[model samples]
Target: MNKTCPNCGALLIKDAWETVETNDNGSYVFKSYLALKCLQRCGYYERADQNDQE
Candidate 1:
């Protein structure tokens, strides 16, 4: 089942999060993750499981 915002009753949306990091040696690392967000933009969000399980 999909998740809904408790305050607004709107369907939650799935989105991706990504970031890049660099070290003093000029090496860089990339990171990404999934998250669920409230469609109403209520500042509600949670990270998705690494296995993509609900």
Candidate 2:
């Protein structure tokens, strides 16, 4: 959808990551989020908003 860096117009790259944590009952919980980074390395990065479409 024409994703680009606001500062340099470089193409934006999507990265997904997840983490696991232990709960009080010893059950594991997982969380995940999406982030964007400038492909040209212009130091532009941001996490996708909760309502943002992938």
lDDT of each: 0.80, 0.81
Give the alpha carbon lDDT tens digit for every residue of 1-54 in model 1. 788977788887888767799989999999988987789898777787764444
For model 2 the local lDDT of residue 23 reads 94
> Candidate 1: misplaced stretches above 4 Å?
18-31, 50-54
Q: Could you estimate the TM-score for every candidate? A: 0.56, 0.54
Q: Tens-digit lDDT track for model 2 on 1-54?
A: 668999999998887657699999999999988878789988787887765544
What's the residue-level lDDT of 3 in candidate 1? 82
Which whole-number lDDT from 0 to 100 does residue 26 have in model 2?
100
Top candidate on TM-score is: 1
